[model samples]
Target: MGEDADVATSLADSVSEEIADRLAPVDAELARRYPGEPPTRQPVHTVYVPADAVSSGTVSAWGEQAREMLDEHAPDAVSFASVLGLPSHLAGPVHDRVRAKLEREPVEDLRIDFEDGYGRRPDSEEDAAAARAARLVADAFEDGSAPPCMGIRMKCMEADVRDRGIRTLDIFLTGLVDAGGLPGGLVLTLPKVSHPEQVAAMARLCGEFETARGLPEGRIGFEIQIETTQSILGPDGRATVALMIDAAGGRATSLHYGTFDYSAACGVSAEYQAMDHPVADHAKAVMQAAAAGTGVRLSDGSTNIVPSGRREQVHDAWRHHHALVRRSLARAYYQGWDMHPGHLPTRYAAVYAFYREGMERAAARLAAYTGNAGGDAAVMDEPATARALSNYLLRGLDCGALSSGEVARHSGLTRADLDALAGRATEAQVNSGP
Candidate 1:
């Protein structure tokens, strides 16, 4: 038995060596792709929170919750108010309700609903309703009583509706500027962006609008709604969240996850698992990739499963959904939508957890770099280490964890490293040894 065991061990070792020899080139190639101690990790400090859609006269339903959450959590992005309670076919009531809400809390950003505020048909009535909604929100901004940030959710820029959507956005933005109600910034929330060209077209129109209005070029940005499976893993399999921003040429401020729509698109089974399933993963992957180096923020789609029944169930549901969000954040997401107020703590927790992870991961990466080379020796490029370094710098900027100088100091690499890596540094640079 002892002789047989020894022979087996000898054969296994020989096979392992042979396999390593065959794989060595691949490992080297991968290593070449990732070099050096990864860029230092930085904690994500600021987080944005956008209020999901709701009905008229119901901003208060979520406003109080927002106020409390903001006070306790102090989220960096806050779109805490919206206009609600209007019927699908009426523009007047919808506009008026929004006006009331703005009067109450000085809404940061106002959303214009198509199916809800305007009728399905692009008739005079629907057009009027959309115009009215745009006018009011613009008025609030021009009057100096509006929130510093402002945006609108417009219909998809599909070939069929492209003309209409562009017309509506143009009218709204033109109204805001002409009425002296233009807010700090304008975001065109485009639903179902299937191609980069779609975003580019919107950008071009925005430029045209800027020229017409005498507004500076690049004054507008896009917030793409990643609600379709195609946007995540279709023929354009690499559709990432960052690509959404890049399509706008540094103008995209955020990427919003469209949960319900995305679920429907992906045909998610076990409907309740939308937030945690493969569909959500692809959606988030897109968003996270878009957000990686761009200053643009990415928001997870809304958790449609609302709070329910017994006190504990409500709390548990919220926590469960929020936990999913926290997971997203830990994986480097910075924003997500909250359909209900109870999800507040979960959002806050996600932010805190991300920061904590950033701090720890960054400190450890830095420590590893220093320890590997006796504290003063420069680090070499190793794939894992390189990725860490690159990610550290990029994520650091996103998280506000490290300044350029500090990053240089810790990594012994300059802003040039940051810039070069950010520009086209390959994944091969991600794993260089220290």
Candidate 2:
């Protein structure tokens, strides 16, 4: 409206464009090399059980198994314990709470394995086992006995194992199709991936499988296991994790860590190949950085120390497993693998403790920053903070750690306000990882 104001506006616009032009190259590189932010419902843990062991009613079976474990170890909640480090006085009550959760809600996702869990078998036996496993999964789907998510973990594409892997997958899929149409929320795990070509090959096969079965295109997605050092950093000196996802032809849904194998690949000794070792941390951090905000879920490797029958060994074993799970949660890896039914207690204990320990603090911080009527507003919330808050509540709710009412009450927000934040999370791109 005024001469001086018009001149100032024009100068500001010109300067802004000049700066933006200089930054264009950096912006382009980011978009080209990384994944755009996407919303995901990440499970707390995937229980990897042997194929020969899986049945349609495995969830109920595991629940019963977990109950037996609690009876033996934490009977009457008085002897209750895990790696949670709760005081002796409070251990019993905490143990009962976690036990109730495990029995009511066992595994989040189940991976019927033909990989490491089921070592190579004779062709006949393997083929028969594959068919049987598929039928079992089909039964699970029909009976609604399946967990929230379920899938198969196929062997890698290495030349030595490729034929066997493909054969088993073929037989299994055929059996599943004949039993029933494929279920939703199914994923295939491709392990020991060291090269992009392997990922591309898996992607190509997924396409062919969907076509052959008359399923929607790209309905089948796969998760790659960063088990090899080569997957962390390839020959090109770039992050191989990124390349492998690219090779998946847009069908990559998640990336999983293989603790022992990755540590072994890094030249660590066998006994020292634990999940939270510094070397393991480096690998996991690389994964988080590469896949963050892209919605390609990240899962930590499992703690192999499944507690034994002996009472003396149980405490130490439980403590170790608990610490590892806690460390993984702290690193923003909400999911990991539970290799044994006995691990259910420790895994859930760690998860519940992690959430409850910080729930009030996180809620207060979020409420204070949101500037609601009761909020302090002393600390302004940024886009990333808001995203983290949404992700935190979403994760807690997903895993059944916090009820809807609890989250709403603590965060000082209504259901509609929470929904708006979740909407913003889906559209925003920022790494909210701690």
Candidate 3:
């Protein structure tokens, strides 16, 4: 009986090896297609200013305006909480953090819009604006006043504007390269991408720019704006967004939904168009699924309702924006578009509240899973859940929702430890073993 069991075990081992050998190509393909999430800090919001309106002080000015709005409308935590219907426990902390965030880093990502925001001008004028944008961006970085990410959203690759878009991009890249090289946080967005072919063209343009400027290959990456119905569903009745990602050839950094354009494309009236509309939700759901595990982040679209005018009007807009932002966060879309300065306060408030509300619970779960604390028998977390918990904490730390000390104290793990657990360790950290 012992000899028979040994023979069966040997046969099982051989079968396993044969299967593995046959699946080697599949393994390689999976790794290539699904490289997992990136370990970078994704900003909570992206603020878009027209190309002509983007001055060096644009970023700081937005912060100041948001601060003033808070001071005037919601002078204290109590009022702010009343306006937003925030819980008493969260009101004080969220209000204080929002103010601090506005003072410190009001805008994490800024995009100079040359598309819908800045309507088409004469060739010479557009060229000058693109060059000026490049110079101002370079100066911002040199003066250490630039946002963590800054770039331009050029026009789409439609037949009529294709050459113009290519020219603008060329001018912008050239100007940046001439201005003592590109900033490390340089971001480029290709707006109104309706087809995978457009995405491929953008990728090819990036490659050509890299070669012309003597920069490293794959140095320039752009976000694909998913604004059209065709982008979500191709003529062939398949998911076109997934094909668009493939067309990008690994140069697509994010997929940003265009709330109004997408809704309009779906035949929704202007009054009904919004970030939380059913059409908007469908588009983003498709985007989220296609971008999953591809190292491509997802960003929700913006609300056209700018918080301006009377105090009551401002509060109403704030409430609307805050709810939408929170809804997006809850749906795992951590980033969105902020069209006006007033959006800043609510943006941070929503982001901070989302992270802080769950901070302790996430830390405890992570600690238990990592063996730093006794396991909670009621909820046995698997490795995937642990990864999610660790990432949640890391994101909180990244966006100032939680401090490093607080995370360490609660989780019994430092930032480095969290990074390791979240699979975000740098190559250097991996090589320098503990």
Best by lDDT: 3
Q: Write the per-residue lDDT of candidate 2 for residues 21-137, one digit (tens) a residue.
A: 999999886665554444546788888888887777778788788777767766654455433466665465457667777777787899999999998989999899888888887
State the displacement of the C-alpha of residue 161, model 1, in Å, after optimal TM-score superposition. Answer: 3.0
Worst 10 residues of 3 by lDDT: 3-12
lDDT tens digits, residues 277-362, model 1? Answer: 77677668766654654545666666667655664565456566656766776565655665555554444434433443354345
TM for candidate 2 is 0.87
**CA lDDT of every candidate:** 0.54, 0.78, 0.90
Identify the superior model by TM-score, candidate 1 or candidate 3. Answer: 3
Query: Model 2, residue 402: displacement in angstroms?
Result: 0.5
Q: What lDDT does candidate 3 reach at residue 154? A: 94
Q: Please tell me which model should have the higher TM-score, number 2 or number 3.
A: 3
Error of 1 at 331 (Å): 1.2
Residue-by-residue lDDT tens digits, candidate 3, 113-217: 899999989999999999999998999999999999999999999999989899999999999999899887899999888899999999999999999989988
Looking at model 3, residue 394 earns an lDDT score of 81
